[model samples]
Target: MAFGSDRRDPYRAVRLKLFVIQVGALLAIWLVLLSIVYVLMSSELYRVLDSELRRSAIQVIQSYDHNHLSTQNANNQSDFGAAYSLWKITGAASSMSATYIDGTPFIDVRTVYHNALMHPSGYSTTLQINGQPYRIFDALVNLRHGTYLIQVDRSVGPTQVTLSSLISTLIIAGMAALILTLVGGLILTARSMKPLLASWRQQQQFIADASHELRTPFAIIRSNLDVLLHHPDHTIESEMTYLGNAYEEVERTSALLENLLTLARADSNEQILNLSPVSLGELARDVVESTRPLAEWQQKTITLNAPENHCMVIGDPARLRQLLLILIDNALRYSDAGACVAITISCDTTSCELRVQDNGAGIPQNLLPRIFDRFVRADPSRHRAEQGSGLGLAIAKWIIEAHKGQVFVQSKEGRGTTFTVIFPS
Candidate 1:
């Protein structure tokens, strides 16, 4: 059951959710972007069409300077020479001249505009004649005697072709972006989760180690108690002392087991944090005070440089306090005699930061990155002897991460180490 439950699928429900989110977001953004491009490009296309219509209208009006309306009026009737739509308003009476050019023929219309009233300067519209489309440019050119309606029509083959090409390009680009986003998002999600998978495997190994470690202490305590039971008549003071020591060892082992269990729950993301606004300065002060005796016992000087005013941040106060204690306790354990351990709490509008600096026999440069990893101890033997199960910093890291915060360390081999905790405000 344990192994089966841990076997995660790549296409799990959570991954599906991520895929949907990424694809939907990308598609929506692309749609909006394409829509904007289409609108702007379409507007520009219409402007070019309108400009050509205006230029054509000016040329056509200039072509007919002489009074040949009557002569051209008779030519309007003939299938061999098709008619074009032209309007001439001589006072209130208007005359339409229909002329044909090549195979294209035009209809006579009184209105200067296509759909609405055509502007006096120029207007353009789509016209269909004999199952062929034409872009018509119309204008009301004012001459000395009367107003002449000039129209110049141009076929929109090139513009339509260009628009078609643009649409194809947009579709291809959108598809490529979507495919890249899906593939890249999946790869990134997998990479992000790799550390979590590694941590889980390490935790399984730690549990096995912890079980063995716990059994040895329990066996020793049990055997010592059994020996005391058999020698009822001989109540040696040394035996009583031995029993007391065994009980203490049993208590220590129990505490270690409890810490391990807590770590396990934290790793599984089962421990829900009771988050609230916490006074970072006050928390640091309390932790510093609590660890003062430990520091003094080790002949180390513990200094607290908490803010004068309360530095508030949103977090689980208890967990934050635990993190502070873990860092301080670690410094005290590893630091040289009479070394200075400084704790500072600072805050801004966006975040609050807690820095714990110690002039300890600092961590090695290479091991600095893995210091927060579970069961990774700087000095394994001393860590065990100091009752440090090498899980303190790891637990601290988990708790900080649960609060959407971070824990990072900077260390110089011989100089000192500084652990920084950042929490969003």
Candidate 2:
């Protein structure tokens, strides 16, 4: 079992612990509430029964008349559920007594009368009479020419039944609530862990990719340094080639580290956008003009398509400029020699649209969904040759999303790729 358990998912134990805590807390609260309700209900029911008994005993004593001393019996309980017994004791002798009883067939007459004489003017909160529970009250009254003891008995069977039913209902309800709490706790914990697990896995992937990318430039720098070390006695000009090669690798490494820092700041929400009104058309025009020289040097052409007037949007100008450059760079990198890269900006009252279209070796259909994910590249070999860390599109995506804009890409292998961006105006 130990070996088998060890092979199971580590999260299972943690998840089970959470489930237990959630369900146990809910069950404890339910039991406490149930106990409180039961106590209140039973207390109220018994209080009513006790009050009725006392009231009936008082009424029986008040209706007693000296003029009716010769009356054999008065049936006071003919209209109520309770039974009554009235005894008149004269001179402390058993033979000199008159008794009147009603609806007390289940009671022991002689014993109850004797008890009434001994414990006069009090309540028997619970008394067993012929195998049933009863609430009995006794009152001793002294009037003209007589001493009388009055007894009132009310059965507690109905109250017992109601309390029993209430307890049974609480038990069933508690069980049902426990089941629901278990199921609900499992569902809630699973849902809560989803984003956390995704973030943890993403962080792991980012670290691995960063290490792999960093190792390449470091290896190149080490090789160049090894060459300079071999020619230790040479002049500065003789070893300048090795020094320049090492410097280029250092520059690439610095750029890669800077890009990683920017992404890290973006992920941690530390890179706050400096928002302002900017002209999209003007920005696109400037980026195209500045990048035209590089395109011509690489045997490619660049053009801008936009309205002559302003296409204003709320965004960070610097971030928008970076975003435009990343897309234009990707278009140029992937296009064949002599291919033309086009930038278009248009706007309406509600939204502004920008497009970077290129006739190049476009992305595969299967890779479109996660193309903006960090470290995801369309062609790993080609990107590595161009010193791409595959973070440009990812950074561009973050910039657009931070500015409350949306990006969409449509591409087909060997045909073309068009990136459409929409910014709220």
Candidate 3:
């Protein structure tokens, strides 16, 4: 079980922790609020009950005083819709106690009368008789005959029923809220981690690809040096070939390092481009002019087609020129000797489009989706003869996007390829 647990995805644990914290916090707050509400409600109910008991006791005393020793008349008086009992007490003994208006005995006569004599001033307490609860108020009264004790009580059954119902409602609502919060917290935690997981995977892939690309140049340089060292007694004339091979590898390594640096800066958001209005038509013409000699040497033709007027876009001129050169270079490298490479510039009301189309061996359909990913090459060759470090298109895409533009490609195997860059006008 421990071995299996160690192999589990760490992010799942992190997500669970986040979900639990959020749900637990919500439940804690709910419980605190419910406790406060219950305390306040119980206090209010008990306060109202105590006030009613005091009022009933006062009314009974007033009636006894007005009737002047007429016990029957005072007992016959209504208790104002409340349950109460009148008791005549002398010393520790009670006699002839009237029952409550509801015909229920408030308490055991002997026990309550004894307690009333002990506490003559007044007091209120709760009692249970015959499985029913009551709030009892006991007080001593001075009448013309002698001192007497009166007890006022109201059944607390109705109040207990209402409080029980309230408790049930709160419990149900709390349970429902807790369930919803748990579900919602889990969903939100998963959603929030999606982008972070994607970025982590992408970074891992980028590191792996970068390491693979660097190994080739290092291996070439090492092999050439080993060959030279094995024949140390030879003269410079004999060693020239091996030395030149080593020099070429070193240059390739340097170029690869520079490309990696560019990508690193771009990834860190430090590649700040100087923006200005650049004429797309003029830039395309200059690139064609510059590459004309190379095209001639390879027995290939280069052409430029543009609008008559200057088509302008906001961009960093140097970076945009680099972007154009990358596409053109790829085209020239892949095309046959007699093929043609075309640079076209067009503009509409909202955007300017620059396309570099080449009649070369186009990219395979499967490789088109990730063509701009660094260290990804269409050809699967490890040899440096025809393939590059595979960072040119990636850098080009980054530069174009930095200027708030987009790069798109349309290619077919064995037909040709066209790379289109669009900039908002």
Candidate 4:
């Protein structure tokens, strides 16, 4: 059982969901990013190519002199950035220059004539060179001597290869990042839920054990009290005195069981709540009035503070009233004689708040967290003869939580304690 309990397996369904979502989002972002990169890089490449082509065309035209004297001097200039083939005409005669690399001319004689028709403006086209493609830009210029045509070509091979490689890299990196994120998130979620799962199991065990413990003691006490009463010599006063203690313990056990049942019912997700709009002012007034007699018996003063007009909240009225009674009862049990306990109802346009503040020996700091835990008491060693079944605060918390409201406590040792409940609009 221990080995089986400790075995760990991946939560595959949740992990798969996370992986798909993360990867899908990353894939979309990468696609957009790669598209933008492609567009911007392509534009910048074209701009640089345009400038280079214009410069090369100007350099080629300057190679000839005003006398129309062609010089071999242009050959030694090393002006052509890349090997290119060129053809030129002087009157009815023609001359040509070819690179030793034996590459086909990117701009042909026919393209130059087309540029001449267009005049000044350039024309661009692609041509094959040594089985590789190059982009060519040709311009026609009417030089002082004669008509001259200049052309430039740039290799597209390296730029295309680089862009394709980068896109592939980005896609691979995005997918890897997505996988790692899903794995990490799944592990974190499981770790976070571990403590809560342990607590739930402990609560289940506690309920089972507490039920058996309570039943035995109660049954024993009741049987003993009954035997004592069956004797003929037993007096009414003695029976009442002795039997009262046993009867009170039984009531305590009953209250504990009742609280557990209420919590069980409340935990059922299918439990239908009797919901209605309740007046906060009226509820506070009624709870205060009902507990007035108990306050007098305990020699404590009870004060109510609420607006004259109705302040409404949406919830189960019976549950709200029960929660109020629990808070007042808890305050009365701990409050010092003659100390004042105030119940205040404050409201705004959107929500309402109820505060019960008591001038009492405030709860110990360490016990504050478990104040709403079943069967947990601040002073466990103290006699339960008159103290409650230790379920009032627990019930109050469950009831408030059921209404989608929050309950909180503020306490300072030996100063006072305040319990606040809030209901949304």
Candidate 5:
């Protein structure tokens, strides 16, 4: 019963594995989203920067052509945060000159201008000059004066700073999101596993109880056989008792196996029943009559009280008979001589009710809650005379539930017990 100490925690392992998978999936998705966002943001930023550089290059060319290459006008044209240069190219006459916003030549202008002149069509490139980053755009313009290569260079320090900040923010946010995802995944895993853990524990307990029940009868049968084999010279009449004992254990084992199979089928939802309208009054009378002889032999009384009207419900007749027999047998087994067991049937407009009440030493309050569980018996010692496979009430409950009905029991330690079953009309 102490599931924690008896076995390993399989549910915990499964939950941890599931949580890891979930967190891993979430992290993957987050990384992909961040990659896409960073790519789009960086691309847009570079696009805007390149556009400004191209505009500045065009302005410089226009100012030079209009001012007839005047240095003053060129200095005024360098208003944006960009450096520009002009290269004149004629047959066997190539010369380059550059200017900056501060009236001083920008560092590495000659190398950049030559690189731009080599690729006449417009292109963008990045350069590191004096340990500062610059984004350069090159354009070739064919003016009336000559073919001019205009190179525009802009400082990328601000853009780099902004991008770095964005990267840092994204990293911080991603870390936070990952932490939250891990926590949520763990919580969800635990929540989802609660029922599964309970079911697993129940299954473990069921298997343990079944094995224990089976081992008893097998041990008895084996012992009886061993005794008989040891007494080989004894006459058949003398060893009849040993053979009979073995046979009884065999019968008990067989019954236990049959009940286990029935429960297994029921649990699997594979036991198809032939549902039909059955009269509760007639069924109760039949059950009482069938069990009357046994009750009388024990000096106990069996009675059936039913309304005059037919109490009909949809169910399998044979299974219902078996259900009733199980309850009656349980009642008789637990009751003493002169105790009364009654089967009462009544109906309302929407449902039919059957109550099996026994004037017996009732079930303990602690066991009452799980009385219908498989292999649960009122008598823990399971005295031989009243011993059963302990599946009768479980089967009875399953049959009632299969018919979309409800079964409940009321019992006290010293008083009697009552089992009530209700089925839709």
Candidate 6:
């Protein structure tokens, strides 16, 4: 056996893998959501700013007249606290018609005002003008006298602050949600793996039990063969006892293997029952007769009791037969010689019932619950003595469950044991 250092924990590895996958999916969704919200919010803020600029430009255009270029409406506070520059052009040559500002223009921003007069393109732009954020746009207006150019500059400091606050809030909230998801996902993943971990542990125990059961028969067969090998000079008759022992061990091993295969197929869902309406009373009679020879060999009397009317149930006949054989054979193996083993059957309108009872050393209360578990036998020595593989009851339980029936045992120590089976009609 290896120490802890050599052991790699599969549970931790599997849980971590599942956690990573869940977190990655959530992170991707968060990224997409954040990006979409950011783009939409930024566009909306800019859109409001542009609308205000357009409204201001429209007011400046309407107030202008070729004969008397007016700056009254352009310089008003309702014009969105803006600065404007206007020009008039009759032909190729143009003149600075009017310039308006709600307050005194700073010397640094005088150049921006000058550029508006120098070049006026019909578009909107954002720029850092004179250490302040500004949205600038130029508009073209045609008058009765000539064409006019207007430039508008609006400070965007407040809008910029709102956008920055929105971005910060989104970041903070998203981070908090991501952290919560990480912790929650780890916990949930751990909880989800519990059933799988339990199943894995059971599988490990099952393999260990099968290995232990197989080892004994193999060892016995090898020992008997070794004895035969030692006396090769003797006639075949002289070695009959050793050969017989080996053959018996071989047969026991074959039965063990066959039972293991049946269980494996059952676990994998590869076993399909051929279902039909089976008469339980008729099947019981057939099983009792076939099992009678074994009862005779063991010096026990086997009898069947059933209702006059047929005990009908929907089931697979072959599996039903196997189930009966397993219970009766188990009874014969454990019962004292000449003990009475009885098979009884009864049916009502809704369900059919069967019972196998033996007057023998009964099962202890502690072992009753797990009596049908694989590789579980009350006495290993007695099971081996009777060539029992310890898997018969497990297979019997599987067959009955496949037919959607239930099997249970009732026993009292030193009295007897009875296995009861119920099938829905």
Best by TM-score: 2
User: lDDT for model 2, on a 0 to 1 scale?
Assistant: 0.81
Q: Which stretches of candidate 4 lie over 4 Å from their true place?
A: 1-196, 212-223, 226-238
Error (Å) of candidate 3 at residue 16 is 4.3
lDDT of 5 by residue, 166-198 (tens): 899899989998998888787777777778888
Q: Which stretches of candidate 5 lie over 4 Å from their true place?
A: 1-7, 10-20, 47-132, 135-153, 181-200, 233-238, 267-289, 305-319, 345-352, 400-405, 423-425
lDDT (Cα, tens digit) per residue for candidate 6, span 277-371: 89999999988988898889888999899988988998889999999999988888888887989999999998899999999878889999898
Q: Model 2 over residues 1-425: C-alpha lDDT tens digits?
A: 12125343446566667667877888888889999999999999898888888787666666655242224344447235577777665655375454553333444545665776676566566888779998787766676747766678789999999999999998899889888877788787777656765776788899999999889889988998998788788888988888897888888888889999999999899998889999999899889989999999999999999998899999999999999999999999888898999888999999999999999989999999988988888876674557377899999999999989999999999987999999999
- Winning candidate number (lDDT): 5
- For each candidate, give its TM-score against the true structure: 0.53, 0.78, 0.71, 0.55, 0.72, 0.76
* Candidate that beats the other on lDDT, 2 or 6, i.e. the better one: 2
Evaluate all candidate structures by whole-model CA lDDT and list the values in order. 0.71, 0.81, 0.80, 0.71, 0.82, 0.79
What are the C-alpha RMSDs, in order, of all predicted structures? 9.3, 6.1, 7.3, 9.3, 5.6, 5.5
Q: How high a TM-score does candidate 4 get? A: 0.55
What ranking emerges by lDDT with the best candidate at the front? 5, 2, 3, 6, 1, 4
Provide the lDDT at 70 for model 3: 47
- Residue-pair clashes per candidate, as listed? 6, 0, 0, 0, 0, 0
**Candidate 6 lDDT for residue 154:** 78
Report the candidate with higher lDDT, 3 versus 4: 3
Q: Can you write out model 3's per-residue Cα lDDT over 368-425, one digit (the tens) per residue?
A: 9989988888776434756788999999999888988888899987889999999998
Query: How far out, in Å, is residue 393 in model 5?
Result: 2.8
Sort every candidate by TM-score, greatest first. Answer: 2, 6, 5, 3, 4, 1
Mark the regions of model 2 whose C-alpha exceeds 4 Å error after superposition. Answer: 1-17, 47-78, 83-153, 383-387
The digit string of per-residue lDDT tens for model 1 on 1-425 reads: 11124444433455456656766777788889987887788778868876766654554455455542343544442221223345554444344443332212344545443322445456667877567776776666677746666656666667778788888988898889778777776676566556756665676778777877778778878888888888888767758776886877778787677778888787577897888888989888877778888778888898888778888987887888888888888888787788999988888888889898988788988898789876677865464457466778888888888888988789997788999989888
